[model samples]
Target: MPRFRLLPDEQLARSPLSQLWREFARQHSAVAGLILFTAFFALAILAPLITPHGPYWQNDALLLLPPSWSELGLVQYPLGTDDLGRDLFSRILVGARYTFGIAVITVIGALLMGLLLGTLAGMSRGVKSSVFNHILDLALTIPSLLLAIIIVAILGPGLLNTTWAIMLALLPQFVHGIRNAIAEQLSQDYVIAYRLDGANNWQIFSRIVIPNIWEKLTLMATMALSTAILDIAALGFLGLGAQAPSAEWGAIIADSLDLIYIAPAGVAIPGLLIFLAVLSVNLVGDGLRTAAKKRREN
Candidate 1:
């Protein structure tokens, strides 16, 4: 009775969450992507505090200055000055607030709306379901960006309008994907058993359908986020999103385009930030997909 025995490794069972975390962590690229995105988010949040100069501040004397490493660079402006003599580094940090922040908010809205509408549509019978499916299919046929642009055109383009337009454009994808996933999960024997056991539609959706399709949901979310970022930037570049005086990444690039020949880094830095944001999100999504697959196999 006084003797205590150590548990065997096999007996020391890990929780499902811990197991999933371990699986996700095994993918080095995913970890790197997570870290990268976190850094970007932090920079966005702390931009006002950490930036050496105001994003809108202009220095007539420092026009088109190169980065600190460049021959003509100044120590004060690490990433150098834009064509307007605004601090390029500060603009970048401030731009991240609009670019990354808007995409995140849009995706969350789309996901929530999708989950509600898709679940109802999936659970509907006969003609109602068919009508929902048809509408979703019709919406899906239009390219998301085109749909977003059309909505923005109708709503009158601005940052808030662009966010709404993108959310609406993304809604159909989430709805259709989730609807199909729920339908597939409903056909499974366990779901049938739940139905036979008298589980209501809400109960079944909450307990069975959602859990089964979480992986798909996560993948769609990441993909949607990346798309939102690009679309926001594109709209901003076209002057239909963030307007003049905004330091949004796309607007930054558009503003700096004229200076590309004279100060290439001005354009390149913002462009590179967009590229990295998209790439990191995609990498993390891919890693999660692989981890989910492996978890299922085991």
Candidate 2:
């Protein structure tokens, strides 16, 4: 019987998050990015506890109130209120949850489907790969926003439909990335050796190709998550997303656009949040990519 030993210190040093952080820390930009990302995620998670009022509750007296250090000499509206007198700060916080939640779901759905399809396409030779790749190319050729609009039009506007729209739009990109990664791995000597050893396609896929490309796929997933969030917000802003009074960032922005002059904070709050969230995600993606590259080099 053979006894298996735990990984030695040197081997353990190469663990995922550990190596990722080390490389990430070496890059100042990545550090800043992580901070931004963490802050927004924290905000989203803690919205209920942090916010002063219900995001959707309206107060006629407070309508269009300017952001101030103190409201009515007692309470304060830090980010002000919308035309309907809803707390901008509170709405922003709650909206963060909606925006982030939809983005996450859409990204995960698209990534899963794309990864499976891409893996199949890459492992196959000749007409199969060609057919899948062509389909992907066709999907990619169409403008994502336009495609999303059409889908939303048919499905009707709502949070779930918007998520579906974004997922369908993003699926092609994930498929392309995974397909490329698998194709590159397929040419590696280890893969050929695994095949020559009479390993079945599924065995080779699960044991060899997947493990090799896991890091890249993770990085792509993170990037796609960020993009998905942005796309969802964009769709919402265009009126093809979450409906009114939903406290979604895009919906808030769209609703506030009319009151820009009367109460700019309504629009600014959601817009700024959307921008920050997307920016933070992008930074995290860059950090993850950098970390992956470092691990690969090591």
Candidate 3:
């Protein structure tokens, strides 16, 4: 009997989740983004264990304290203390949880709605396509920020409301992308063959169309994740997102703005984390797109 060894690439690509992971790891920026994202997530998840103080608790003695150096025998505050004497580091860790949670929820909601609407529109050509496409165009024509503000204002401010706002604002893009992909797929010979093989519309859609376009959908979802994070941060900055006492990054930045001169690190810390998170998401999205294109070409 011959000794057998599994090929690493072959094994990875054979598993559904591992295939994407392998693709992510092979790209330089994607790997870096994954590392940064994982670090932030870990910080968020392990906040209580790592943080010296609760994010909400404040101490007057520590108020507006600058970052301390061990050499100076003053090492209490690592990232410094905010105006209320709360640890900036702790707040940031908690804020990551809030921001990322909202983004993930919003993205998943938008993708679900868009996929359903887009698939429906694609399966039905004439009047259905026309109406759906017109609606999508109208939605796309509106400024996303303005739309989000309108929705949030109508729904009232809160985490749930903010998420709904982001989802509504994001749905149009997904609809548009999926509509285009599905329309193109419908024109392919495989679809015609499926139709001729006694396959009903639903069967053709479920078995053939969806699987073929899933890769594109995954790419869109990754890009949407970045956009969702940015949108939520913007909403928080404008006071329409995670409200006060929530330790959200946007709210943290908003509160720290007035105290920038007093403790610049307060604003800088949250802002830096938001920036890095969004950047990492975008890098990962770009890497996915590149890998997907290569896969298609091959």
| Most accurate candidate by TM-score | 1
Best by lDDT: 1
How badly does each model clash, as a count of residue pairs? 0, 1, 0
Error of 2 at 98 (Å): 1.6
Kindly provide the TM-score of model 2 when superposed on the true structure, using C-alpha atoms.
Answer: 0.90
TM-score of 1: 0.94
Poorest 10 consecutive residues of model 2 by lDDT?
A: 68-77
Candidate 3 regions off by >4 Å? 1-24, 70-74
User: TM-score for each prediction?
Assistant: 0.94, 0.90, 0.89
lDDT by residue for model 3 (1-298), tens: 9977665676645754455556657889888987887786676677768777788888898777787753322466678778888888788877877787678778889999999988887777788779878988998998777889899999998878989998999999998999889889889998898888888988877888888888888888878888888878888889998888888888888999998987777788778888898887788788877777655443
Q: After superposition, how far is residue 5 of candidate 3 from its true place, in Å?
A: 25
**In order, what is each prediction's RMSD in angstroms?**
4.7, 4.9, 4.9
Put down candidate 2 lDDT per residue, 128-169, tens digits, no spaces.
778878988898888777788888999999888998988888
Cα lDDT of model 1 overall? 0.90
lDDT of each: 0.90, 0.82, 0.82
In the range 124-148, model 1's lDDT, one tens digit per residue, is 8899899889989999999988999
Off by over 4 Å in 2: 1-13, 70-74
